[model samples]
Target: MSALLEADALHLRFGAVRALDDVAVSIWPGEVVAIVGESGSGKSTLLRVLSGQVAPDAGGVRYAGAEVHALGEAQRRRLMCTDWGYVHQNARDGLRMGVSAGGNIGERLMAAGTRHYGAIRDAAAEWMVKVELDPARMDDRPGMFSGGMQQRLQIARCLVTQPKLVFMDEPTGGLDVSVQARLLDLLRRLVGELGLAAFFLTHDIAAARLLAHRILVMRHGRVVEEGLADRVLDDPRHPYTQLLVSSVLAA
Candidate 1:
């Protein structure tokens, strides 16, 4: 498959810290690529650059064969609204606490030019069911929900627009283990059913293994190893990657 998103020779720096260095990666349609490493390893930085949230000091990002950075701010925003979704590590960051769950999902539909209230409401309810949330709770505010519920609602909101690609940052990071497992299962199912491509960042090897088809291990702003998820996690080649895999196994 051709690449839906590509980052070439990416480099970024914050003062003396190099957040990304010559990072090159690609994501194809219906694929999930995970960037995994310890904190400060530049995994998040890479995600930001790839998603066009941050411009690299030296490099380029392309989406669907167009230079992403070359687009005007309004164009970029419109592209993000229509073709891409971003799920932040914190549900609060992705969700509007004051808005009803259905309202949150419907807002994206409206942004995408849906004007009929009934259709928007129906779509939001349908997405709620898909994410395992009760459609009856669609009127409740996100602040009234649990952390896991908020995250699920966030996912529903993002997917309701049928975005071709989604960017997620440590999606399960703050949840309880059992909740995380359920969310992961739901996410896997949604990704498969929708045929959506995803670029996810995580420090958890198990999360990467469960959700990612391909894994890129980063350290010191550089990718130390990358391969199929099973290969990279089971028999990591780089010492850093080996240590990451072993630590997860030992836990």
Candidate 2:
């Protein structure tokens, strides 16, 4: 099967700091790949570049078969609204806080040209249940929800359109430890049920272990290790990767 998303030899720099240096990645349909790294390690930058939110200074990104960076802004936006989904690390960035939860999900359906109000609402309610959110609270605004609830709402909004590929940046970050595990479980179930291709950035090795089939360990704008998630984490080859594992264990 062809890769659902592909990035090769990516190079991006901000002043003297290289955000990405000769990075390459690919995701197959129904497969999940996690990019794991510390802060400023370029995992998030790579995600943005792959999602077309930021254009790389060099190299190529293709989704399905189209050249991602070459597409017009409107085309890229349209692709995001329809075929691709992005879950922000912060729920606030991905959702309109003022809108009710149902409306948030409905908006994606609307973007896809769904005109029937009943159908949109029904789909929204169904997704709310799927994400472990109460459909009864669909009328509540994100600001009225807890942090975990807000994050789940953001996810519902993303998946409502049944995107083929989803890019998630630290989806389980910035949450209480207890909540993170539940959210990760929900994400794993959703990804499996939908058979979606996923690329996510995370510092939580446990999250990567639970969700990703493959893992990429990054440092200083380059991928230092790549392999099956278990192999990379169990017997990390690079000294940096080994340090990452040891640090997790020491915590």
Candidate 3:
């Protein structure tokens, strides 16, 4: 299987702090790779770099076999025009609060250079349905919805473009326990059904086990351990991985 996304020898730094230190990972088509790390472990930074939000200090990022770092700003923007969606750790970061739900999703189509109003609206409605949201809520602003619903809307908006790859940062954060579980279930189903490849970042080991086929465990800005979820979580080789697993089991 070809890698849908690849990062090789990636390194990034902010002032004196190194965020990503020679880290590497890859995702193939139709695979879900969970990035598990404590805060400041560079998981979010990796996603930003992959999405072209943060340029790496050194290393290579190749998407669909194209050299991402080599592209001009306009060329990269055009390449990513509608081929990617990002759900930030905070739903608000991924949404425009003033816009109606339908408008939020429609905005992506617009950015992709789509101009037909009817087509954009229809696409937004279809995405809302896929995320299990009611079409009637299309006119509602995200401020009117529950936290869980807002998160779902963000997901719907990003996945609407039928992007081959989606990046999610701590997606279930800030929701109540039950709401988190429900959203996770919905996300798992949507990814499976749509055959979308996801790079899901989470600090929660249990969530990683639940949602990922492969797990990459990070500590101090490096992938300390990586393997199939069952192997890494069930038989952790790194101390940090063991600690993470133990904490989840204890909780």
Query: Candidate 1: TM-score?
Result: 0.98
- How far out, in Å, is residue 40 in model 2? 0.6
Taking all chains together, the TM-score of candidate 3 against the true structure is 0.95
> Lowest-lDDT window of 10 residues in candidate 2?
242-251
TM-score (C-alpha, index-matched) for candidate 2: 0.98
Candidate 2, superposed: residue stretches over 4 Å from native: none
Q: Please tell me which predicted candidate would have the highest lDDT against the true structure.
A: 2
lDDT at 90 for candidate 1? 99
- State the RMSD for candidate 1: 0.9
Residue 28 CA error for candidate 2 (Å)? Answer: 0.4
> TM-scores of all models?
0.98, 0.98, 0.95
User: lDDT values of the candidates?
Assistant: 0.92, 0.95, 0.89
Whichever of 1 and 2 has more lDDT, that candidate is 2
How far residue 149's Cα lies from its native spot in candidate 2, in Å, is 0.3
Please, what are the lDDT tens digits per residue for candidate 3 over residues 99-207?
Answer: 9999999998888888999999999998888887898999999999888899999998888778888899999998998999988999889889989889999987778
lDDT by residue (tens digit), candidate 2, 89-201: 99999999889999999999999889999999999999999999999998999999999999999999999999999999999889999899889999999999999999989
